[model samples]
Target: MPTSEFDLIYRYFSSLGAGPAVDLSVGDDCAILRLEPNERLATSVDTMVEGVHFPEDMFPEDIGFRAVSVAASDLAAMGARPIGMTVALTLPEADEFWINTFSQGIAQAVSEYRLPLVGGDTTRGPLTISVQVMGALPADKALLREGAQVGDLVYVSGTLGDAAGALAFLNGEWHPEPDAAEFLLQRFHRPRARVELGRELLGKATSAIDISDGLLADAGHIAAASGVSIDIECGRVPLSSALNSHPDSESKLKWALSGGDDYELCLTLPEEVPTPEGCTRIGRVTKGQGVKVDQDIDFTAGYQHF
Candidate 1:
């Protein structure tokens, strides 16, 4: 075992973060970061717990990668560009191989997002990882959840339900074809934050939220925040081939509606504005409150952390 916590940090987590956005990194009590002129900082945190958030036996590297990616998804929702992150890791004890693999996963996400690992803490406890991501965007350009207007059209980036499908498979609800199984599994393990697409919507999207919960639930958030009702066209919800291959149509649709963890962005745009590339128009904001779907689809709940 490592002699001390500092030794563990130095050996595994220290070198994973290095970049211009960070003025001072892991060795300090606090990370010093620099922001360009006219830039506003955005920060969000997400914590993953073993056996609750993920399967206890999942690969250590996958757990690390997911911790960073899920945290960055919040920044993506606000149309911010990620610059730095701090990971507070808890473990039962120091396992050299586990630490190395986990750090490698974090390094991969850090490199892909161009974020520096700034600073965090490590302690002995039940396995848990909390990642805090910091990002920045031009002043007054964030896509907030409170900006939707009655006339705005609703759109979603990429397909939904794949992650949910993976969850179903894990729970032994259904089995998909071999190819679809792989695709769904990957979608759950490595969800993209849609950073570029979010940036593209900076001035275009009226309101935005990343789909950490099910579509209906997250959309309801925008509706509730903006004080406007959202009506979704269930037929228009996009599904991947993997999701489409599910044996039961209603079950598949339910997964898309309430299964959560998709990590895609759902936003509202002006009706006259053209839909951004890589996004699909699925609904519209209306004059009432709460979210209503077109189909008889009964599922309306999302993942809850209570």
Candidate 2:
């Protein structure tokens, strides 16, 4: 007998939906949620296609975790507190082993992010995962991309280019020491979403964006939205020791500048505001348009799907 969709939900996803805000979760037509007074909901969705968003041989557990984390990153960018999430998963076949392994990852994220799995759909077709994350924010308070002003210092949370470096290692571009290889691969497999840091920045940051599309491109978003130019001191972009193990400085810098999927936060703070720990000041907002980099490196706008 084949496993039914209902069976999959009951066995794998049913228990992952319990949370403080979830009134109704899996097994219901619609999940109900409660919001605090004076709080508004912030929601965003992200889709990960089998080959397009991840490598063909990527682990199922990593895929499940990555899908949820990437979706949650949008909430982080907006300085929202995660409340719940939904997953719409499509698979070519209902492989029990694969589903079980993937569900472990989902369970892990649900626990770590404190984001309950509300409701979603499972169907037959190409393998794809679409995750929608919902967060709560104080009314009238959100870190937006349009609030950056001239002279604000630009900052980014955490190191950049580790995921891109992991890709390089996977493609056999270059080999690093065992420790570096392990670090880079782990960075790719389980990228952290800066949720707490984002919340801490709500009042201090003038403008912010998550670095999913590389620094140059994501920073360009703030510039365009805020109608200001951003000048980046390429020498100041922080790199992890693992990434620095790569022999080619130019390639590492290119990955740092143009490599999408870092999942870090890029924000602009006023000159008077103190820089937060674990974040590096990379540049400043200037009176102009678009983004300008001090280094002479070849790169494009960012990742694009067409």
Give the residue spans of candidate 1 off by over 4 A.
300-306
Model 1 residue 220 lDDT score = 94
Per-residue lDDT of model 1, residues 1-306, tens digit only = 345755965777788668878888888678888889999999999999998888888888888888888999999899998889999888987887888888888988988788789898888899999999999999878999999999899999999988888987877777888899999989898888888888888988999999988898899999999999999988899999999998788888888877788899999999999889989999999999999987786554533321
lDDT of 2 by residue, 73-154 (tens): 9999999999999999988988888999999999999998899999988888999999999999999899999999999999
Indicate which candidate wins on lDDT: 2
Give per-model TM-scores.
0.95, 0.96
- Give the whole-model CA lDDT for all candidates, comma-separated: 0.87, 0.90
In terms of lDDT, the poorest run of 10 residues in model 1 is 297-306
Q: After superposition, how far is residue 262 of candidate 1 from its true place, in Å?
A: 0.7
Show where candidate 2 strays beyond 4 Å. 1-3, 300-306
